[model samples]
Target: MPELPEVETTKTSLLSLLEQTVLNVEVRQSSLRWPIPDDIQKLRGQKLRKLTRRSKYILAEFEHDSMLWHLGMSGSFRLCDHYTELRKHDHLIIQFEDIELRYHDPRRFGCILWLDQNSQSKLIDTLGPEPLSEAFNAEYLFQKFKKKNVAAKVAIMDNHIVVGVGNIYATESLFNLGIHPAQPASSLSFQQIEQLVVEVKRILKQAIDLGGSTLRDYSNAMGENGYFQQTLLAYGRAGEMCVNCETTLENLKLGQRASVFCPECQPLKKVKIAPQKAIKGSKA
Candidate 1:
């Protein structure tokens, strides 16, 4: 699925649409994860005013309403010349006076929905802070982790704890921090939590700069592939030698997602709580 960085790249490339009036819209296939809203055609004469991203969803603000777009497991958008030939799996098309935007998805898990100007989406309203935002500081994570007994990887991947730390980025971030993915979330110390915050922000920013990691079916609005996959230290390197230490990286399943880590670098500490002594004057 397209994560934050991938979504951000697409949003950035579509920035030129701002102040441009929508000329037409065609829904080749409305059977996506959800049906493309019939009212989407109402955008025909509205001007695109702003474009933003929340988690993996792109918010395109129009003069009247807005649209929420999600590029599912294999969905992408491309910019093309006016009347360019539509490709297979091209589910939706939005045209401007001089150009067109096409949405392609092989799996059809993506969504295109309309939003009222003053409405809030339940999808985004309850999401935690963006991983790179100031609100996602160490203190915030520390408090959230306190109540989570799940694995560190699972906790960080939770949308309520932090947004956009998907399986790929979460695995990579845990590996880079020398923290085992299966480590209990509440067991992480303040120092480790602090480092995790920094590492997640750094990795996410770096991925965005590199155009995101394209394992499969991911590309920018221009159809250019991401280069970050070439720089991965972990995530897909199961049974490969660790770059930090020569130990072979191992893959473990956590919450049904593969987590790759080096045993030598990220050791899962087993805390043993000592048994309490019996009371001195208690009856036998």
Candidate 2:
């Protein structure tokens, strides 16, 4: 699945090229999970403004309209020649007057939603704060987890709580902060959570710079893709030695997702004692 940084990277890479053209978008395919009305009829000849992004969505605004695309797992926007050979499973295409933009998905989990201008705020209004947004600083996250019992990783990954902290990024963020993935939200200290906030932003920024971690199949707008996978400290290095201490990297199933971490680096801390029940003085 494309995380927040990956989606934003895609928007950044193609915005410059797409903003340069005043061409119409002709839809060759529109059978996604959501309706993709004739691309040309809806977006043709309209001047495209800057590309905007929210969460994992890429928003392309037009004269009075906007287009929403979600690169669900295994989905990519590849730029191919207008006359290039169309391969199998190329479900969507945006034909520019001069060149065409193609969407290739093997799993077909992606979505293409179209909405009128300024109407999108309502659709994505309830989503959580962006990880990079000012609203997501340490103080903000701490408030959300003040007395929560949920695992800190799951809490941060919740879309309604904070956007774009996926499994990979979550694992990486926890590793960077030297915090165990299974740590309870209520047990984390304010200082530790603050470190996590900083690491989250730093990792996301670095991933965006590299275009996003590309191991299986992830590419940028021009099909360049992300290269942060190479810098992964522990994400996919299960059974391998921890780079820092040479300890074997262990893998565990957390919330049904594979989590890898260096046992030494992310030491598990025991929870503090719970409050003891008081005598029934109120009933007396």
Candidate 3:
């Protein structure tokens, strides 16, 4: 899935479409995460006024309403001239006077939805604060972590706690802070939480500056792969030497997601295990 940086890069790549009128809207495949709204045809002749992103969703504002786009797993958008040939997975195409915007998703998990200017979406309404926003500072995260016993990694990855801190960024952020991925959320002190918040913002901003991690199928609207993957420290470097301590990095499953960490750098408090009762005469 395209995370915050990828979405932001896509938004930046789409500035050319601003103020351009939609000459036509074509949906070669109407079925996606949600069906392409039948009313999308109503966008024909409407001018695209602006393009912005909230979390992982792209918001395209027009004269009367806005459209929300999500680049699900393996989804991407490309801008091409009208003469460019379409590929197998180019599901939707919006034509402008001189260029075209094509949405391609081999996995069909992305969505394009129409939103009225005055209304809000249930999907967008419940999301937590944007990670880059002032609202997501260390003090704010500390308060939110109060009484939450979930793992720190899971807590940060929760969309309700903070948006756009996905698995890759979350793992890298925790590793940067020298916090064990499995450490309980409420166990973090105020100072640790502050460090975490800073590292999260730093990692995300750096990734955005580099376009984003192109681990798989991610690309900007220009079809260019992000270079941030080259600088990654821990996300996918399991069994490799840790940059800080030179210890072999270890991998584990946390909440079913792969987490990599350096045991020497991120040692956790040992949890006590109860002694097991001996079964009567077998092994003895």
Candidate 4:
């Protein structure tokens, strides 16, 4: 599944190519991995003025803003010239005068939702803060986690806590902060929570800069894809040695998703410890 950065990247690319242009939208296949709206054909000749994101959604707002689309798991946006060859998986094709926007999905989890955008309705309003925005920071994440006993990794991944911090990012963020994955969200001090927030933002920004993690089907617009696939430290490397420490990484299931951590680097400290001077009588 593409996270916020990937979606944002897609939106950025689409905006440059398709913004303010009238669209001849066609659903090459309406029934996808998820339900496609029955009135999908109404987008024909609609001028898309807004290329915006609500949570992980890429919304191209038409003149009325009443009709919006949601790109779900495995969905990708491609900005192509009209002459560009179409692949078998291109399910939704939107044609403009100079360019074409194609939606391709191998798993088909992407969906289109029709809604009244007046106050965000159910689709956009339910999401929490964006990680990169000012509303989201260590204090916000810390406050949200104080009431919960869930693992810190799982809590951050919860869209209810903060949208777009997916499982892959949860692992990466915790790893960067030197926080063990098993730590309970409620048990974290303000400092640890703060550190977690900082690392989350930094890691997400870095991953986004690298065109997002490409463990699966994800690519930005212009067909430029994920570069972090080359820089991942702990993600999908269950038995690999920790990059920070020589200790082998450990894998466990948290929230039924694979969680990886370094036992030596991110040890769960039940009690604070300070090392003595290696049994020397005086400081050497």
Candidate 5:
């Protein structure tokens, strides 16, 4: 699935649509993760004012409302000339005066939905703080981790705890901070949490700068593959020598997602807890 960086790159690539009026919309397949809004024709005359992203969803802002777009498992958008040939999975097309935007998705897990200008979506409203935002600092993560006993990898990937830390980025971030992916979330110290915050932001920003990881079907609007996959130190380097210490990296399933780490670099260390003392006046 397209993660935060990929979604951001896609949004950036569509800037040309700004201030462009929609001439027509063609929905070759209305059935996606959710059905394309039946009344989408209401956008025919609306001009696209801006584009923004939250987590992995792209918001195409217009005069009266916005459209939320998701690049699901294998979804992508492409800019094309009006006479360009449509491929098999070309599910949606929006025509403009000079160009057309096409959406292609093999898995059909992506969505395009309409949102009223003043209305808030429960889906967007419930998402946790953006990982790169000031609200997701080490202090914020430490508080959230204190109440969860799940693996650190699982905790970081939780959309309710922090948005856009997908499996690839989670594994890489943990490895970068020398934290084992399977370590319990509550085991982290303030120092470790601080390091984790730094590494997550660093890795995510680097990925976005490189156009995101093109491990599979991900691409920007111009159909360009991301270069970050070429620089991956962990995540899919299983059984390979670690670049830092030359130890063979291992792979395992954490929360049903593939996780990779260097054993020597990220040794698992359980936090020691003091035994509870019996209360003076209460029964033992």
Candidate 6:
């Protein structure tokens, strides 16, 4: 699946479409994760005004309406000449005078939908702050984790807590801080949460700078592979020597996702706090 960085990279590559008039809209396969809305044809003759990303979704703002695009599990977008041969999975195409933009998905799990310029979907409305935004600071994360006992890794991956921390990035962030993936959410000290917030932002910026990770079918909108995978220190390194301590890295399942970590580096330690006693003069 295309995570935040990959989606952001795709969004950047697609900036070429801005201010370009749409000459045609083709729906070779309307059946995707969500059906390609018949109204998508309305984009024909309209100008693409802007492009932006929210979480893993891409928002294409046309002159009068907009499109909410999600690059599902195996989806990708590429630009090719108008006369280029279409691949078997090129489900949708938007043709301009000079080139064509195609959406391809082997699994057909992506989506292409049209929306009124002023309308909003529950998907976008419900997402938490962007991980890179200042609103997702440590104080915000600490409040969300209070009284929650879920594994720290699972909590961070929650979209309501912070958008776009997918399995890969979440695993990488925790490993960077030596925080055990299975540690209780509420047990994390304030300092740990602060460091986690910083690490998440730093790692995400680094990933985006490196063009995102090309795992499986993920690629930039230009069909170029990302080089971020080369810098991975923990993810997909199970049973391999830890780059920091030479100890063999270990793998375990958390929230049904594979989590890789060094047993010596990320030990699960839950702090126990003794209950406070009531003061004699205080109301019982």
lDDT, residue 103, candidate 6: 96
After superposition, the stretches of candidate 1 with alpha carbons farther than 4 Å from their true spots are: 117-121, 272-284
lDDT of 3 by residue, 1-284 (tens): 78898889888988999999999999999999989988888888989998888778898999877888999988899999988999999999999878999999999999998865332557788799999999999899999997677889999999988999988899999998889999989889999999999999999999999999899888888889899889999989999999999999999998899999999999886644457799989695
What overall lDDT, based on C-alpha atoms, would model 5 receive against the true structure?
Answer: 0.91
Candidate 6 has which clashing residue pairs, if any?
Answer: none
Query: Lowest lDDT 10-mer window, candidate 1?
Result: 114-123
lDDT of 2: 0.80
lDDT by residue (tens digit), candidate 2, 1-284: 78988898888877654554445454455766665665446666666675888888888876767778888888888777777898777877666656677778777788777765444675577689989889998888888888777778888888888888888899998987888888888788899889988998899999888888888888887878688888898898999998888989998887788889889998888888588787887553
lDDT of 6 by residue, 1-284 (tens): 78999999999998988888999989899999888887788888999999999889899888888888999899999999987898999999999767799999999888887654333546777789999999999899999998778999999999988999988899999998999999999999899999999999999999999999987868887889998889899999999999989999999999899999999999999578669899989997
Q: Between 2 and 4, whose TM-score is larger? A: 2
> In model 3, how large is the Cα lDDT of residue 92?
99
Could you give candidate 5's per-residue lDDT for residues 1-284 as a string of tens digits? 89999999999999999999999999999999999999888889989998999888898888887899988899999999988889999999999878999999999999999864332456688799999999999999999998777899999999999999998899888888899998999989989999999999999999999999898878888989899888888989999999999999999898889999999999989676667888899975
Poorest stretch of ten by lDDT in candidate 4: 271-280
What TM-score, over all chains together, does every model reach? Answer: 0.93, 0.89, 0.93, 0.88, 0.93, 0.93
Quote the lDDT for 77 in model 2.
85
* Tens-place lDDT digits, model 1, residues 145-255: 986778999999999889999998998899988899999898899999999999999999998999998898788988888888888898899999999988999999998
Best by lDDT: 5
Q: How good is model 6 by TM-score?
A: 0.93
